[model samples]
Target: MNINIKFPDNSVHQFPRNTTPLQIAENISSGLARDVITASVNGKLVDVNYPIQEDARIELFKFDSLPGKEIYWHSTAHLMAQAVKDLFPEVQVTIGPAIENGFYYDFDKDVPFTDEDLEKIETRMKELARENLEYKRREVSREEAIEIFRKMKENYKIEILEEIPPGEKISIYSQGNFTDLCRGPHIIHTGKIKAIKLLKISGAYWRGDARNKMLQRIYGISFPTSKELNQYLVDLEEAKKRDHRKIGKDLDLYSISDDIGAGLVLWHPNGAMIRNVVERYWIDKHLEADYKIVYTPHIGKSELWDTSGHLGFYRESMYSPMLVDEQEYYVKPMNCPFHIAIYQSQKRSYKELPLKYAEMGTVYRYEHSGALHGLMRVRGFTVDDAHIICTPEQLYDEVEKTLVFSLDMLRDFGFRDFKIYLATMPEKAVGERQNWDQATESLREALHKNKIAYEMDEGGGAFYGPKIDIKVKDSLNRLWQCSTIQFDFNLPQRFNMEYIAPDNQPHRPFMVHRALLGSVERFFGTLIEYHSGNFPLWLCPIQVQILPISENYEDYARSVYAEIRQHGIRAEIDLKSEKIGYKIREAEVRKIPYMFIVGQKEKEEGTVSVRRHTAGDLGSFLLQDIVKRLKEEILTKK
Candidate 1:
């Protein structure tokens, strides 16, 4: 029988029913077949060797594609696992999956993998890759699979097989002497992984459950060329230098103490000052934009959460309830419920439509202790949250305005490059289909009207509604998810939010949840890394450090500092009994933007020597002139 194959460009070609994707590629061009790693056969990812038995849509993937890279990395992971098994015969593999940047495999082993072990494993992986072993897949009956694993004494595989329903096909992939249970669309052979690097090793709980046994996880990445791998290594080193935790400590910005508990940040005076400045700027902009700022409590009653459906769908991330006056009160994981409560507090009118409520609300959520990072993943953080309550007619305009505002704010914060994602409803989403469709269409229309290009994330939205997620590119070219504007069709219907219409009837108001900066702590962390501790003059905690050459010049330095402070520049005098060079070095180490040096010549001439942190001396200038320049920069937020 002949089958029709549709290409991505909508071109169709006739082929035999048993023709594989590889054969189709080869018929087109040998180069395409050589580069093809995987394919989407009728929207289902499958190996190129899989037969096409019917007319279907086919999209072949090369290493340049995301799915192709995933397949390459996953196949490299299996190769690494094979090497580990070769080196350690007793280790049992549980699961190995591809992540955002790389892949990791968890092993059930008594002995933990060390740095030396990774080197050996990488060596072995290279040796195995040179052999160009083929990854062959076989489908077996559940009983046969269980018997195979049982005979091999791979208890983890046996346990996994028990969960599989009877009469279902269990796929097993084998390469050389290594075999694993997987649903794979891997690369044809291991030789494609030309450059490999085992990044690191860490302990991870089996299945991410605290109650489960801890397993050793080895993370690794691969590239098709040595040049790409080398460039990646360079980027990795730069990332370490820009790591927020290290920069935070070096700058004395924030600290996380064991006594204070993990995932909780204690911002020192410097960090607090930066945060205060950011908050003031945020508030001023919000007020200018006609946002009604409000404060909400950290906890809400269980009944309130029940009505909001947070207890039903989002309870896992929430803390356990606390008893207050015989009633259970839980710490809020989101500010939406409180905002809803405010909306429901009194009768609203359509004339008051598009009521923008903004808040820097702090909320607490439970994160796994192991999953917690420096400031990115925290238990408690403040969100620059806002809710826009509007009528159906106003939804599109409101969303568009929010999108423009969000992009403007991000650009102001030095994020010029962005990738926006329009996430559609998930399978488990709430609200009626009509509501979801309307909300999704509004978001799509906003993006289209604004001429903003965005990628669609199919079935990747929140349970409530569709959303627009903005990811900003940092200095290192790394993407960080920051802004989100989500429509909530479930909340208004659940709370029965009503506003008086022109016809004297109650109508539901559309609720939109927006967080342009996401969590303040996370944003601050990103800011630190983006600038590599060299914050702009406006955001720097210590804008100017006055360094006196000797104790005799302290008075002049103090006067210079006072004068700078008068111009609203954050300035401090270095009074420590240290040499001039030492003080200058210390100022540079602290990442102070400017340094005002005072000495006999400067004091006598009524001028201060100006030195930038990284840019040497900037000649001498009158204290007033220096202050004027600094004020101009600060006012301009340069």
Candidate 2:
């Protein structure tokens, strides 16, 4: 029998029914066969040896593709699990899956796996890979699966099979002496994995449910070539060096204390200063863009959230309501409801359409203690949030302005590359079909109008609306989720928001909720890692640290510092007991963009020796000339 297979590029090929992706790759080229790691048939990741029995779209994935890397790492996880079973037969494997950078496997065991155990597992995995074991998939009835695991004393596997819905197909992957329950898209054989490393081990909740049993999760990574694995290890080291938590501690920027509880951040003086600059820039930009600055209370009546549907959808993350005079009040998790109330204070007309309200809104969420990490994932943070209430005719312009504004803001802060995703409506979304269609079209048109290309993230929108999320890429090519523009239809109807049309009839206004920097805390964390603590002149808390060689020259250093400070530069005088080189090195470590060294000669000549944080000594300059150069760097607007 013949089956038509449509390639990712829409080209169709006829192949015999039950053909495998590996066979297809071999037909293309021996080199492609060697490089191909996985395949997706009609959007489902299946084993390279899995048979395609019917007409479908086939996407052959290499290591360069995201899905291909996922498959590679996932197979490595299975190998790790096999190794663990071989060494510790008492342990039971529950689940193993691939993540962003690698893969981890959850094991139900009496004892936790240690670093030595990880080393042994890595060795066993290498031995298994060298055996060139073929990954064979077998399908059995659910009852038969349970019986087989029960006979083997694999209670965990039996439990998993019992929990799965009846009538669903049960498939298991077998390699040599090890067999496990899995739905996989593994490479042709274990030998395809040439390089592997066990990274770490941690405790995880079984099935990710805290109420369930705990499991030991072993994390690992793999590559087709040792060179690629070596490069990955190097990148991992660089990422560790750039971790914001480490930099925060070294630079005295922010801290998370055990006494203060988890998910709460305490910003030091320097961090506060940087935050002030960021907020000031945000306010100035919004004002220049004709947005009205607004403020809202941190807490509001519980009824407000109930009306906005947040109480129903977001109750788990929200704090319990406070009772005052028998009425419950809740801390704000979002600023949207309050903004809507303000808009309702008075009647609006079509002429006042596209009313842009911008705010630095602080919100609180009940983040889990274990999940909290530095400023990147926190419980409390301020959002540089805004809402544009516009007529249908104004939707395009509003979205376009938002895109341009966000891009310009990122570029100004040293982020030049970004990944964009246009998310359409989800199956569970509210609003008329026509409304959703029109809103998605408006967002699409706006992106095209600005000449910004974006990929479609189908059904990846919020429950109330479609949206576009922009992930900014840093100097190290790390992607951080940032600016977002969400189009909401349910809010206007739920809040009864309206504007009088030209014909004097009240009509529903389109609501656009957007945030350029997303959360200020997350942005700060990304910025610290993006530049590795070397912030630009504009955002640097202490742009210039004046180092006086001795106590005698402190006065001259103070004078230069005051002169720069008066000109709106973040300048400071360091008069600590330290040598000139030591002080300079300290300032460089702190990531101060500029350092001015003051000595007897500099004081007598009214000159300051300048050094850049990243660049070495830039020679001496008159105090005024040094200020001028620093000012130019700060004022280089996007």
RMSD of each: 5.9, 5.3
Residue pairs of candidate 2 with colliding backbone atoms: none
Report the lDDT tens digits of candidate 2 across residue range 484-544: 9999888999999999999999999999999999999988988888778877778778888
TM-scores of all predicted structures: 0.78, 0.81
Per-residue CA lDDT of candidate 1, range 114-226, in tens?
89999999999999999999999999999999998887788888888999899899999999899988889888888878999999999999888889999999999999889
Against the true structure, candidate 2 reaches a TM-score of 0.81
Give lDDT per model, in order: 0.90, 0.88
The ten-residue window of minimal lDDT in model 2 covers 472-481
What pairs collide in candidate 1?
A: none
